[model samples]
Each structure stands twice: as C-alpha cells, then as structure tokens.
Target: MRAGGNIEITDLMRFGHLAAAVFAGWILIAPSIDCARRGLQRETPLSEWEHMDTFTTQQGCESYRATVIEAEKADSKNLYNARYAYSLCVRDDDPRIKGE
Candidate 1:
C-alpha cells in the first residue's frame, strides 16, 4: 500500500483526531506556560539522598530522614528560583521604569 499521499478518514475519525491533537497540544503547552508564569521551576536531582549515611543505616529511619531532607532542599530551591524569576518579571513590568 502506498503512503504519504492522502488517507481516507470518516467525519467522526477526523473530529476525534482533531480533538486528540488539541488535547495533546494543551497538555504540552499548558504546564510550560504555567511554569513560566508562576516560576514553578524544576529542582536539582537529589537521588543521592538515598545513599547518604543517614539513609544508609536503618531502612525506615533512613528513608524518613532522607525524605525530610530532600523535601526541605526542594522547597528551598523552589522558593529561591521562584523569587528570582518573579524579581526579573517584576523589574521588566514595573511602571517605575518611567521615573515617576
């Protein structure tokens, strides 16, 4: 069978394909735009916490401490990054730039 010329599609199939395309586009673009707007940036990988001393001993105790540390570190990094991005956005958009 030949490919890449033209394929037949029913009306329902065409609508379904269009809906899927739109849904996929929104799934891809919405989070990124929200991230840019709110500065919900990605944090550095901290999987090393799993192998740290505090976590390498007792499995349960270690897992708890590791989770706490990892969460705190992630929170810290997120706050700093978000503030930095917000400051940048604010600087660009501030009306005080006109020297009023």
Candidate 2:
C-alpha cells in the first residue's frame, strides 16, 4: 500500500494526466475569459448610453448612419433614421467610445 492508502503508480499517472489536461484547458480558455471580462466592463458603462438610444463606438454609430441613409435612399421609412440621428447627437460626447 502507498502512503495515500492503496493509490498505485497507475493511479498517480492518471491523476497527473488529469491535472495536466485541466491546466492545458485553462490556458486555452484564459484569454477568452479575460476578453469577456473586459467586454463586460466596457459594456457596463455603455448601458447608460443605451437608455438614451446611442452607441459607444464610432463604427457602431457609422453603421447606424449608413443603415438610415440606405433606408432613405430606398424611400423606406423606419426607426433607423431616429437611431442614426440620436447616435450623431451623442457621438462626440464620450471619447472612451473608441472600440473593443
């Protein structure tokens, strides 16, 4: 019998392999977990802007503008126009609204 009761060499090897697999999995997933944490942090403040119907990134605001413009060009009336206008109104208000 081993020091830990009946744990043999094979059992120790299996435990080592399991530990290594778990470590590797954590390494692979760590970056994504960090990215999600950062994304959440960035999004939390932007939620306040959401209530005012605005975007937190230039790309987002520009995309909204383009959609509205396209809708107008097609002579299609929709809510995108108002959203684009609102985005424009708040575009320069938050400098931290760069991007992710």
Candidate 3:
C-alpha cells in the first residue's frame, strides 16, 4: 500500500520461490561435491588389478608366509593399542569412550 511496501501474499510467495531456488541449487551441487570428496573422479587403470593378482600369485609360498607374519604382527599391535587407549579414556574426563 505504501511506497516500497509489497503486499503480504507477494512477500510470502517471493520468500517461497527464493527458498525453492536455493534448495534446487543445493540438490544439484551436493552429489557432485560428494563424488569429488570420495575420489570418484580418479579413473583406475585397467591393468592395475590384473598386475596385482599376477604378482601375488607368482610369489607363491614366500608371499603367503610374509602375509601371515605381517597379519599376526598387525593384530597384536592393534590389540595392545586398543587396551592402552581404553585405559587412558577411563582415566580422562572425556565422555567419548565412556559407555553404560
């Protein structure tokens, strides 16, 4: 009714249109952002997996022994670290690891 004053319905419609536009823009952009963040942009070379399988099987018995030894070491180390971290968490005031 006054100068520079729009009607209530017009204002509400404008606000809704603006909100819809923003939402549409976000919907379009979100998947692209996720894909880039998740490294989907990188194209894997076709031969890489083939080469890895060939190399793994070619080493035969030695590779199997080495893999088992490494796995055992990793398991022991993880167990030790987990226990130490849990004990430290109990002593601290942080509620992250504390549970009922």
Candidate 4:
C-alpha cells in the first residue's frame, strides 16, 4: 500500500495481469461463442437446395444445365432434377450480374 493507503505498484501490476488474462481468454473464445449463437439462430442451412457453379463461358453453364435436365428426365424422382429445375446461366462478364 502507498503512504495514503492507495494501491501500490505491485497491486497495479497484478490488476493489469488479470485484465490481460481475461482479455486473452475472451479473444480465444469469442469466435466460438459467436458461432454457437449463430448456429442456434440458424433454422436451416444457408443454401439447402441451391448451389452456384462457376464456369469460364456461357456454353459451359448451358452444358451443365442440359446435363442436369437429362439427368432429371432420366429419373423423375432424382433429387437433382427437383432441386435444379429452373437452372439459368449468367455470363461471368455481364455487368448486370455479380460474380463470385
């Protein structure tokens, strides 16, 4: 204790160390806590049935769409056909569309 019963240098140092430890613990666990909270809040997966496919050209996307259609036609009960029936191609270079 200081002459006036105030906190001494050692006490300050101890408090600083404790604060540092708490801060470090929070940093380590913050992400996990946030992820857990998000998991609880999420009722379903972000994209349960939809997926984005990137292709170098429009023809590639068309080809994939055709393939998906054929696969659907081959088996109406196929899950892929039901999920991707209205598949459309967007040009990567098109300014109106966003690219990933």
lDDT on C-alpha atoms for all candidate structures: 0.34, 0.42, 0.32, 0.47
lDDT comparing candidate 4 with the true structure: 0.47
Clashing pairs in 2: none
Root-mean-square deviation (CA) per prediction: 17.0, 15.8, 21.5, 18.5
| Per-residue alpha-carbon lDDT of candidate 3 for residues 1-100, written as tens digits (9 for 90 to 100) | 5547667777889999897645431000000112335422112322111111112122453454345446556566554223222211011212322231
Alpha-carbon TM-score of each model against the true structure? 0.19, 0.27, 0.19, 0.38
Superior by lDDT: candidate 2 or candidate 3: 2
Regions of model 2 farther than 4 Å from truth: 1-52, 76-100
Which parts of model 1 have CA positions greater than 4 angstroms off?
A: 1-9, 23-100
Worst 10 residues of 1 by lDDT: 24-33
Clashes of each: 0, 0, 0, 0
3-97 per-residue lDDT for model 4 (tens digits) = 77687898889999897655431000000112444322122332221335666556667777778778678787654454455544654333323
lDDT of 1 by residue, 2-98 (tens): 3566564665589887876454310000012144556432341221111212211234443554454465565665653333332211121123322
Number of the top candidate by TM-score? 4
> Where in model 4 is the C-alpha error above 4 Å?
1-49, 93-100
Quote the lDDT for 66 in model 4: 75
What is the alpha-carbon lDDT for the whole of candidate 2?
0.42
Local error of candidate 4 at residue 25 (angstroms): 44
lDDT of 1: 0.34
